[model samples]
Target: MASFKKYRVDGGKFSLASIDPADSPFLEGDEQAQRDRLEQLAGELDDLQNLLHAEGRRKVLLVLQGMDTSGKDGTIRWVFSRTSPLGVRVTAFKAPNDDERARDYLWRCHANVPRSGEIMVWNRSHYEDVLVPWVEGWIDKAELRRRYAQIQDFERLLAETGTVVVKCMLHISKKVQRERLQARIDEPAKRWKFQRSDLDVRKKWAAYQHAYEQALAATSSRHAPWHVIPADSKRHRNLMIAQLLVKTLRGMELAVPPADPSLDGLVVV
Candidate 1:
């Protein structure tokens, strides 16, 4: 039960003064027990999703942000695989297209925000405008500061409009990331997963960490807090995410809407 702390950027390094995922007590549990709980949580989350969709009163937005090969894909696969696809939408944001670049940075993101009665999972999100661009030095210091404020405002607006935002940052150590990257290179089917750019980014790992630190600090708020889930163990990561999702949705007090009385006596039978 380690407490969560906001991260800050300083001299190209993430400064998390008093937080570390390795200190999480949940990881001390037995592996099999954790997996069992994960399955249970997933079931409850599926139920909650159905209730939310039927109610048609509120929306849920789950934002997953992580480094390349940090298991964003795997998290989606294992944790959300059983949820009803009809009410769930997953959007993976890659580099901006020409049209996206032409408008405001938040334009593409705002357009994809989930409507009431739906659940939208952002693979990567508008945070990228502050994250990647800032780390890569594509934007100046002043611009980065302005974008951070704008992001906070954007999320506040979403919360005000009945969209519950749950942001999770999948955290993996440099050593674990290297092992995963090497495994991808060693396996034939996974070889395509590795790219030269990954190595280039790895070289600037400190810079990326700093960028993430700044992004998390600037965006974490009462309406939307970031959950830094330790991701060195895929099973643990998946379990934590499933548990968090179930808890958040269940706490929202979702209930099925009443059926139409006019249709009650019109059955085909």
Candidate 2:
């Protein structure tokens, strides 16, 4: 575990390109050692989740936003591998449906928030309101600014209500993304994950990167900050997010509820 001080973004001047996608600051071991550390962190997270459930006071929300092939699914698969589904839940947001489009953008997301004693991971989030629309020219500068302010306020509301939001922008290199996309096309086992529309979006890489930088700069707050994880290395990506999550949960100092004195001597037959 290392200090992630440099990676936290809080409405500051940020350049997505400034951070290398290949760098692994949080990683410090061989393949075997990395595996051991990740497993340890996963086990610790499961325990923390249990304590969170027992305490039953607050909740955690993990927001994963990334370009295609940034390993968002893989991160969730491995980071929470040791946890029970009873305590953890995941919601993956896709293109909005007609009902979702009829309401405010955050409506769908607000409905999926975590309950007390639970950790919720959002594969994509309200951020898409700003990102996709802005990238496609559907929203103007004025609209984008408004959306950002709305998002900040929305997150603040969640924080006021006892939600700890952890936002991670999984950063990956264009070269690596190309390789991953090609793998999906070439590898039969992964073909199901491939989307032809992905190539269409890939053409707007520069625009999307710019949009992300602006959105992150405008929306990242003290209550819900964003961390840019260099995801060129899949192992490091999983390790960093898992470690970040475990660390966040530990900071809550979760513990079981006080024992009831009346039942102190009770035992099952």
Candidate 3:
């Protein structure tokens, strides 16, 4: 199996320039073989999730951060296709409403933390608080620095409390994003998904990229490392995330509780 180490953001010198958005490092064999492998991984993930639920003591939190048209929804759809909804949950963070603005930025995210034995996936997470504010100049350097520290502390709290945080930044190319946005505009069935605001954000792509780079670097840690997935190729994005997830759950060595000795001689009527 291909290792995901190369994709990890190891603090200091890590940057997106080293990764090619179209590269398919995890791809193997031919097209059919790749598809088969993805299905296999999805099934493995389901089985692992069942073990996690049965264990009923620890949890997994997957945080997916990316720019527009970066396949956050697509990743969730395909990766969890075989997993039961009973044990998996998703939270999509949007622009702050008045209620959200009333609290500190992490308030909403802290509320949505996964319970024991559940797998909670964040489509866009608290990182947005920092990214959007910093990019739009709503906050300054001191605030940005403080938020980064607060995020790291927040994740550390989760880690110390038995939640494993898995963060991934879906690194899609600008060209690929343009193609996807155009598809939304041109395809009649997809027109409703298209928003003029998406174009407005697209105009500030470089600023967002810089924001992402800063956020990922500042928050990434041993407790919650960020992996950059080359997402120009959708197959690569799905495969890498699925593989990484299965690997993470497996590493946890989850298991159900031991049977009670009192039941040894008992049989159901």
Candidate 4:
């Protein structure tokens, strides 16, 4: 097994170009084998999630960020396929609505955080505030820096309060994204997933990549570290993320509550 540390971003030293989206360091065998491994990992995840709910004492927040076609939704679907919905909640962040815009950027995110003993996945997250605004030239460097600090602080607060934050940046190449976007246009059923605005974002792909690189580097910390997952192969991406979550949850040492001595002599009717 490859150590996830290899993919983790060091403080203020991340380079998006350093990792290849097509790289599958954690993968083994052909496509079928990868899929089988993913299924196995998914089963482990389900068990771990049950233990998480049983323990009823810690929160988990998974933040997913990526370029268009980076498979953030697919990651959640396959990785958590066996876990009960009661244990996992997903929140996909779209553009800020008028109500959202009125508050500080992290306000909406704060409201959706996981409660004790639950896992919350953010499909797109507060990082978007830093990415879109800077890439579109809405905010300058100083403002971007401030937002980064705010995010770090917010995540630290979550950590101090018993939330374990695990962030992943789904890494994919421009060529792969183009192929995915084109496939969405070609496939009738997938056409709804394709948006005209996605093309607009594609035009600024380089800018978005730079923005992500900056945000990732600036915000990755001991409490809320970011992992870069190579995502060109959907199977490999699912396998990697599943393994990551399984490993992280296992480390939490989750277990069912201790039996009460007073109930030892009692029998159910």
Q: Which candidate number would show the highest TM-score if scored against the true structure? A: 3
Tens-place lDDT per residue, model 1, 125-144, is: 99889888887878999999
Candidate 2 backbone collisions, by pair: none
Greater TM-score among 3 and 4 belongs to: 3
lDDT of 2 by residue, 1-269 (tens): 58787778856688788889998987887889999999999999999999999999999999999999999999999999999999999999999999999999999999999999999999999998899999999989999999999999999999999999999999999999999999999999999999999999999999999999998889889999999999999998999999899889999999999998999889999
Where is the poorest 10-residue window by lDDT in model 3?
12-21
lDDT against true structure, model 1: 0.81
Arranged by lDDT with the best first, the candidates are 3, 2, 4, 1
Clashes (N, CA, C under 3 Å) per candidate: 0, 0, 0, 0
TM-score of every prediction relative to native = 0.90, 0.97, 0.98, 0.97
User: What overall lDDT goes with each candidate model?
Assistant: 0.81, 0.94, 0.94, 0.92
lDDT of 3 by residue, 1-269 (tens): 88888899999777776788998899888899989999999999999999999999999999999998999999999999999999999999999899998999999999999999999999999999888889889999999999999999999999999999999999999999999999999999999999999988999999998898888889899999999999998988999999999999999999988998988989789
- Among residues 3 or more apart in sequence or in different chains, the pairs in candidate 1 whose N, CA or C atoms overlap within 3 Å are none
TM-score for candidate 3: 0.98
Task: Count backbone clashes in candidate 2.
Answer: 0
lDDT of 2 at 217: 89
